[model samples]
Target: MKKYKYPSVLTIAGFDGSGGAGIQADIKTTSALGCFSTSVLTALPVQNTRGVRKIYPIPIEAVADQIRAILEDIVPDAIKIGMVHTPQLVETIVSTLSGYKKIPVVFDPVMVATSGHRLIEEETIKAITEKLFPIADVITPNMDEAAILADMKVVSLDDLYTAGKKIKQLGCKNILLKGGHQETPIITSLFYDEDGHYHSFESSKLNTNNTHGSGCTLSSAIAAYIAQGKTLYDAVSLGQQYIYQAIENGMDVQTGSGNGPLNHFFNPQKLIKNEMV
Candidate 1:
């Protein structure tokens, strides 16, 4: 008999009843990438593809308890964080993971939803920058989020470059500034690291409305690859490829009336099991 353990990724985020984003998207992406997935719900949002109506944040103690329980038994190889809606929640998460500095933490500064709903409080944004940014191995912020974090209107490539530099100065070791909002045929995502090095990934923008969970999916994909021991650069590149394919595959599939989710399991992997003699 043989038993094998799979690489694991823990996602600390909100729960979207819509299942297109947040913990749901993170779990789907992690599992699709062949990593075992665990999650801690930070908030529960009454949301669908159309929009988010209300958000119920989980108690700080409960959030802390979930992380402690998981770390005591199955410490994750990597972690993905999203949607911390308050300063207290940010402090709770930072405190919980501070002991495990070796684990790669991919933080998606989820300040706003795809449907233009604000997700985080104004003070929470400040807390994420001050508390979580320094500890994050990589922070993925889309155009809107980058704008808020950088305190600038990011409307052009030069603006993205400037914003990336500014965000790196704010204690983040690595930054992936997503350029999906650019009104262009190609989406150019920028990657800036602590060594003053930058890389650009350009992909043809898919003409689709089903991009509700793309940001969450990308961050989790990166975490999954990192959990499998991929370099930060490789993880970002591979994660981008994975999200691109998911979007392309899901472009035509209708999930809801508004923006829908990516086909996360577009290319699914078979689960491995232990055999007993």
Candidate 2:
């Protein structure tokens, strides 16, 4: 007889009490993708479909304690990190994760707002650049975040290559520059692998305000697939497909007034079983 377990992903993110984004969305995504989800809350943002009003930061030590607790028990196959807002938190996560260096880490650099405002202070950005970027297996940054990381304007598809290379030079193993923020009808995402090859993924942009947690959902899906032994390229490709369906399926469904959320459970998957050898 053989024992079995579900593939798991540990999401380190903020709390979205609305259950649309942050850890809530992460959990929904991983669950739908047939992976067990664990989480560490870094901040509690008082947000809804409208917008984020206030963000209460979790203490640095408390955040670290949560990470350590998860790492010690029911360990994850992959880690998805989102919304580390402060310098000290960044350092603490980096230091704690340092001991367990081999796990695959997917980082969604979540500070750049939809309107292109740099959300965090300068020093926090510095810590993320210097400490966190190096450890991430892949960093999924939107055009706005990429512009900030690469120190250049990423206004066109042509700029994604240059910006990705520039950010890649910052020491991250891979970059997935998402073009969903573009005003164009067709959105294309460029994945720059660790080997320096660029793979392109495109989808027709659906017109909808229900895209609140799309980023969190996409990154979580990628981590879930990675936990299930998908290759980096495959994980990203599948993630794009999953998010596209989620958005398309829920485009007309009303959830809130401002920006609503994707349909994470439009097609839920059964928990995947892995043999415990």
Candidate 3:
């Protein structure tokens, strides 16, 4: 018998008390995908399925220290970032990641909660757009977040294309415009690459309230698969399917009074740990 240590994936995001979204979902998705997951907390969210009650962001220096300390010991194959609630935090991450040139970054433009509450500050949007977007390998933005960043209402496929173009111009290598919030029977996710190519992935939309943490899960899944050597398109494609199955499987489970969490552990992977026999 032999043993091995799996490669690690890092998630920099906020903390959710309900364990539905943010870093919690990222960690869950990474672990379930057979990658060891590490995390740096960006914000402390007082929230449940009902909604976000309060948000307290970590100090910029502290955030930097956390990432620096983690990077020193483990160079993650890929990293997923979410919920940079302030301009300063966004700036700090940009500076820190810039120093480490090799890691692949998956940025989830997490701006709102599942219950329709804003998570990031209004003043920080510009910093994220100008600073982080340029550095990210991939940026995942849902309909609402895409609309906010693009400064327009994304109500249809036409609006989605416009939004994707607008975000692509911000310098992200790839933009995944998620269409979960649209009121339609089929969900269409749009991906625009740096080479001026567009891809649309469509799936049957599930009618359920357990859609919380889906964006985080999908982005983290992409990062996880990428860490294991999958191409960007293949990673995102499989990530979307993973998310769709998680949502479908969790549709029947009751987790809370409001929107429930996704089934992140739906298809678990066994880890081959390093050991001496």
Candidate 4:
């Protein structure tokens, strides 16, 4: 008998029944990118494309057990973390992921929702900065989140670089500062690596509201590419391209009453397989 395995990515994220964001988005993105996905729910956010109403964060012990349960048996090739709501949750995740130092971790600091709702608790910021940042291979923060992390207003391209440097100084290996919130037709994202180098990626901002899960999709895409053995630079680059295409393809579709979701399956790939080593 022959055994086979598919590159797997574990998504530690919140739940969005709307299927536009959170764990749903992560799973869809990873699956579409040709990687198997496992998940650990960190929160239950009552949300839709319209907005977020309430968030119930899972207890730390429960989150820990969930992480251990899957991680112990089906170790993933990469991890994508999202929507950590409490300081204790951050500690729990950091401690567990610290054991798997070799796997690349993509941390998307999901502080606020697209509908102007705050997701994480206040104290979690300090814990995330001190404990979680060190373990993450890449941290992707939108402009608003970057401003909070950098402790200043991130208003321009220069602010992206400055804030990215400040974020890296907090022990993150690399930072991708997303500039989507800027009022420009061309959105630019800056990638600052550990070596103090900056790479910029730009995409024409599509005039559409069908971008509910874009962030989760991008971060998961990066992790999926990494799980498939792409270099960090290449993973980030490809992730951007994938997300832009998803958004472009989904622009006209309507899922809910408000902001819709990206078309994650616009170009789905067959799940890649390899013989178990």
lDDT of 3 by residue, 126-200 (tens): 899888887788999998999998899999878999999888877788998999887789879999987989999
Worst 10 residues of 2 by lDDT: 112-121
Over 138-186, each residue of candidate 1 has an lDDT whose tens digit, in order, gives 9999999999999999988889999999888898999999998888898
In candidate 4, what residue range of length 10 has the lowest lDDT sum? 95-104
Rank order by lDDT, top first?
1, 4, 3, 2
**What is the Cα-based TM-score of model 4?**
0.97
Error of 4 at 110 (Å): 0.5
- Candidate 3 wrongly placed segments (more than 4 Å): 1-3, 272-277
Backbone clashes, candidate 3 = 0
For all candidates in order, the CA lDDT equals 0.91, 0.89, 0.90, 0.91
All candidates' TM-scores?
A: 0.96, 0.96, 0.95, 0.97
- Candidate 1: give the clashing pairs: none
lDDT agreement of model 4 with the native: 0.91
Model 1 per-residue lDDT at 210: 94
Superposed Cα deviation of residue 114, candidate 3 (Å): 1.1
lDDT digits (tens) for residues 1-277 of candidate 4: 8899999999999999999999999999999999999999999989998999888778888988998888898899999999987888898998877665467899999998988787877898999988878888999999989999999999888888888888888898899898888778888999998898999999887898888978899999999999999999999999999999999999989888999999999999999997887
- For model 1, the superposed segments whose C-alpha errors exceed 4 Å read 272-277
